[model samples]
Structure formats: C-alpha cells, structure tokens
Target: MNTTTLASTTRLNPVSRPLPVLLAMEDDAEDVGRLSPDDRLTCHVHGRWIHQCVASPLHVNPITRHRWCRSCATALTVSVDELSGAVTMSCPRCGHGASAASARLIVACRASLVAARRGSGARAA
Candidate 1:
C-alpha cells in the first residue's frame, strides 16, 4: 500500500489509548485565583477589566477622569517583559506614556505576569 493510504487507514481505525485519571481529575478541579488582574473579572462601576480590556479602547478613571493617551485618544496596550519583570502600557498608535490609571494597573499586574510566565515552563505531567 502507498504511504498516504496507510496513513488514512491508521486514522480511520484509531488505536485505543488509555485516559489519564489524574489529568482528568485535575481538569475538573476548580481554578481558584487563576485569574490575573488583566482577566475579565467585572467591577461594579467599570464592568469587566475595563482598564485593561482591549475592546474598551479607552479607559476613564472615575475619580480622576484621566485618559491613557489624550493626544492619540487610543487605549494603551499592555506589554510584559518577562526577562526584566517590567510591565508597561503604551498607546498602540502614538507610543505615548501611560496615564495614572494605566501606570497603576501595569505595576499591579507585573508580578502576576512574571508568575504566569514562570508557571508556563514545561513540567512533568
């Protein structure tokens, strides 16, 4: 038989593989505290991660009324430098500095981003 035919036959008649019990259980387990600051956890006034959500496009501080990039009028994109553990948000259009709110959010999410990167490393599964 040709290589293609053999491959198709193997796919059609799939081999039965044993399911991993531990993995299945772990999948069912609730992921508490898995959400980072950037996640869609809703705030009463701001809605879901309003300060960080890309869909929002503009973040207005309720208290200060400060906008991320006044000149560009565009929302800042969050970037995490995993190597340096430095988090920064900058305007996608003009590369403007972050506003007061954006700066605070960057500082808050830096540790979380670093932790996430470290946890993403290959582990014995």
Candidate 2:
C-alpha cells in the first residue's frame, strides 16, 4: 500500500471510538475533539466531507495521477452529485484522467455522500 495515498493530516490523540463510529456520530465539520473532520470515509486532508470539498490542490498527485492529468498538466476536476450519488474526476482539457487512487477516492466519496444523505453511517455497538 502506498502510504501517501491514505495518509491523514490531522491533530493526534488517543480516542476510544473507532472510525466508523466517529464518522456516524459527528455531524458535518464536527471535530469530535480528537479526530479531524477528515475521516477515512471523508477525505485525505482538509478535514471536510469527500463530496463537499475535493477541489483542494493537495488532492492532486502527479506520480499517482490521482487527480492530475499528467499529459495535460492539469488538475482534474471533481464532480459529485449528492442526490444521484454520482462521483467523477476528469480533466477538463482532455477528459481522461482515471486512476487507481482516484477510483478509490470516488468510491469513498460515493459512500460518504450516500451515508450522509441517508443517515446510514455505521453505528458502534
């Protein structure tokens, strides 16, 4: 696994609740004290929802081509439709920037968006 892809940028501390639980319990932008709003199901940084804020420049990765169009040298644009649960990342110049990392990010965004809208996030036992 590439550590860079999933690395989290957040303040650290010991927290008892697992990730799913925290994601479910905390509302949008709620810090939950220890964890950043940027959970695994949310984002890699920016401490924001996957669907809400993926346009950050930090999301671009040239090596992994996550949100970068190497040939065009452009950061791919993110499109997410909460109502339809659709998510996509593509380069505006050429419309071709699919990548493994971006695919994973898309899946995460779709799940997070669906769960947030439906209030179906996993609950702790």
lDDT, each prediction: 0.40, 0.61
Task: State how far residue 102 of model 1 sits from its true place (Å).
Answer: 0.6
Which of the numbered candidates is closest to the native, going by highest lDDT?
2
Give each prediction's root-mean-square deviation over alpha carbons: 17.7, 8.4
| lDDT of model number 1 | 0.40
Clashes of each: 0, 0
* lDDT by residue (tens digit), candidate 1, 1-125: 12222112222454321123212222233133323322222222332222224234344443442336777765556665657766666767988845666655554445334333333332322
Displacement of the residue 83 alpha carbon in candidate 1, Å: 3.7
**Predicted candidate 2 versus true structure: per-residue lDDT over 1-125, tens digit per residue:** 22322213221322344344534444433433433323345553554566777767877788878788888988999988877888989999999977777887776677566545443433332
The total number of steric clashes, by the backbone 3 Å criterion, in model 1 comes to: 0
TM-score of each: 0.38, 0.61
lDDT of 2: 0.61
Minimum summed lDDT over a 10-residue window in model 2 is located at: 5-14
CA lDDT of 76 in candidate 2? 96
